[model samples]
Structures are given as C-alpha cells and as structure tokens.
Target: MNGQPGTTRAAVVTGADSGIGRATAVRLAQEGLDVGITWHQDREGAEATAAEVRDAGRRAAVQRMDLTVLPEAADAVDRLAEELGRVDVLVNNAGVGTAVPFLELELDDVREVIDVDLVGPLVCGQRAAQRMIRQGDGGRIVNVTSVHEHQPRVGAAPYCAAKGGLGLLTQVMALELAEYGITVNAVAPGEIATPMTGQEDVDVLTVRRPGVPLGRPGDAREVAAVIAFLSGPGASYVTGASWSVDGGMLRMGPHAGSHLESDSWRRP
Candidate 1:
C-alpha cells in the first residue's frame, strides 16, 4: 500500500526460510519491495533469505515465527511490519502437513496441522489486513495453498481439510476485505522441489512425474513467480481466486483414476 505515488512498500512472507517462501521473498524484493522473512526452526535459512532480498537492493527483516504457538506467534507479523516501516503485501506461505492415515491419525497431530496450515494464516491475515486498512492504502494477501486444496490425498486427511477450508477462506476474505482495498487470493501448488517434499536443491527437470502434465516436479521459483504477480499491480483486478501452479496435476484426476492398474494409489 505504501508503494502508491511516492511512498516505499514492504512485504512480509511467512516461512521464508526456504522453498517457495524463500523464493517468493526474493522475487518480491526484485519487484521493488522490502521483504520481511520468517522462519520456524531454520534461523540460518531465514537469514539467507534476508540476505538474498538485500542483494536485490531492498531492505530485509528477519523474524522467527512458530505457527503452532497460536495468536502469540502471529505477532511476528506486527514486529516485521514495524521493522519494515510499512507492510503493503503479506504472503502466508508457512504450512505443515501429515502423512498419517485418517483412521490412525491422533487428535494432537491433526490439531497441529490445522493450527499451522489454517488458523495461523487466519490470524496473520487479520494482523496484516488491519495494518493495511489503517494505512488507508490498498494491499495484497497471497495464501500459499496446495493442489490438495481442490483434491484429496489418501494419507493427508488433515492437510486436505485445512487446505480446502483455506481455499474458501480466501474467497471470504477477498469479499470482506474488498471494501478496504485489500485483495485476497490463494496459490495452490503441486509436487514441487522443496524441502517439504524432501527434494531441496534437486533439479525438478530431472525428476520424472508422469502423472503431471509437465512430466516433472515443479520448481519452487515457478510457484513464486505466480505469487509475485498476484502481489503486484498487474493483478490489481484479481481477487478471491485460487491459482494452480501444479504443472497441470489437478487436471489429471480422471485420467489418473482410469489409468491406475493397481491399488497402490489408494495407500499413502
């Protein structure tokens, strides 16, 4: 919002220590916005992301955020906003998932996933939107969802539920925030080469994924590019929409269902 006529702007990207979060922070920096980087357990990775933002000739601030900590943990957004002077964009990129079967899932684990993936973003978005409203300038909020937001996986019941809820939450936020000149959207990513997928530093092109239309795993930067666009002026008219950055994975649902020769896809 501060990037109006003559003011400077800043963006806060949660879980920016690595993967898509890190890439988004750097990309937003390249687009002429100072970046606030957050990490949970990877302080070094957060610092590295901040350095990348700085190298892009933009200011960078680092903060440690534990989404599991609830309302208190979301305070990192305010702290980063204060450090950066103004927050014009917020990327809710931090998330967690589980592989436990639904029937075997412990209540505690399910709660943890929901807390990190859904509640955390809800609170963070509130904090950021409040600041943007007070600033009286338009702002952007991009939620980093997953392809599971639209489809479900066998062993990720909580993850799917949280993401599905978030996809709708994005629409509600967009509608409610529109009056305040705030745009809300979600970016759903598929199999990407990231630490979350245990594929950090691996070349996506070399990893074959026949089910995906792209025939390979996606790169974190590829998702970041779409996020950056949604966070910028070019996407001013876009709101409440969920963009899929899955290399066409979501489109293969029926195709995959019919091609599967065994029950392997049924298991986690």
Candidate 2:
C-alpha cells in the first residue's frame, strides 16, 4: 500500500464478512475512509458490513475473495481500488486454520492453510503495494496474523507454520516496500470474541479469557483500533512490526512452567 501526501484514503479488508475484518472495515470507515470488503463464503455478512460502513457515511464496495485462487484473491483489491478511486490501505485479514493433529492432518489441509494464510496475504499485499507504488504516494498494509504467528499451539501445526511465515514475510515486505513509501505491518490477535471463536454477536469488552494476563478475550474492535492506528497518520513511521492484541496471552509462556495447577490449558 502506497499513497501520496494528499491522496484520499481508501481501504480493502479481506474476510470482512465477519470478525476482525468486519470491525476493521467499520473502524476505518469511522475514521473517514471508504471501505472495500471481501468474503469467501458469506456475501450476506459482507453486505452487512458494507451497510455498517455506509451508516458511518462512507462508501463501501463488497466482493468475493478466496485465497485458494491466489490471483482472484489479489484481483479483489484491484477491483476495490477501482471502485474507491484509490487504495491507501490493504488489511490482509483473511485466514483459515486446521485443528487436526500434525500426524493426522491431511496434505490437502496443510496445503489449504498455507495457501490461505501465508501465500494469499503475500500475493494480495504485493498487488496492493504495486497499486500504491503506482499512485506515487506511500500507503499501509496490515496483515492480521495470530498469536500463533509468534508461538505454536497444539493441533494447529499448519496454522502456526503459516502465521510464523507471515510474520517474517511482513518484515521482508516492509524492507522492500519502504522505498515506495509503503509501510507493511502485522497485527497478531490472540483470541478475539468473534464468529471464528464461536462467539458471534459478542460484547467484546465483557468477554473473558482466564488464561490470559488481561483475563479477557479481546474485542474485534480492540484489534481494529490497533490496525486503525497503523493505517492512520499516527503510524506513518511504523512498519515491519507485529502488534499483539491478545490480552498479553503471549507473555504467559514462561509463567506456565511453575504455575500449572491443572491440565486445562492443554485442552483444545
């Protein structure tokens, strides 16, 4: 994502049909930018998000995006850029995970996870950056990685690998795209109270996660607020960094050794 100093800010957020993507699209709209939203299996949810953005008095364009078809996924951003007349932000929030154990996980499942979580974002980010580079002003790209991006979790081998790879990819993109004035970053959310976690229509502020330091599940808006910061003027100097919005869940690792009172944490 690259934009000039005076360019109108527009954003394309994948997986916007629900969850963090939806919150991000809405939040960016509230911040005064038009939004383009995409989804693979939920056009209704995407439209709902569009309505929310419109309610915020911003234009919204909805489309289908499936990272399994890499080119089509990338092209979704182009379509949005055309509709919004500019592309200043690209939030790569679409991702999938498999819970099957490493030994039991199918090759196809691993392939799908890698394609959706890692390669998909890489390609989509490149497309957005290319447009931003052409636009002559730098822009922003925020990849919605996961806590797994920094550490592994049981039964999530493929997801951990893909997010871990995406973390490094964010750095590489930041280094290369900096010349064009584009900033690339990642937002690693621990456990957001959204449909992905079987917690739809949730009040994020009240969600609890006893396992984390904050003792709460993060709201999608909390994560989006961080993404908004990265996309807005305040984060102009920030790039190639991964912001953790997981209620400090990532910091619990060291304490687990001596604090284990039960095996509940190991339960999936």
101-157 in candidate 1: lDDT tens per residue?
889999999999999999999999999999999898889999999999999888999
For model 2, the stretches where C-alpha displacement exceeds 4 angstroms are 1-7, 256-268
Judging by TM-score against the true structure, name the best candidate: 1
| TM-score of candidate 2 against the unseen true structure | 0.93
Q: Supply the TM-score for candidate 1.
A: 0.95
Off by over 4 Å in 1: 1-4, 257-268
The whole-model lDDT of each prediction reads 0.92, 0.89
Instruction: In angstroms, give how far residue 251 of model 1 lies from its true place.
Output: 0.5
What are the TM-scores, per candidate, against the unseen true structure?
A: 0.95, 0.93
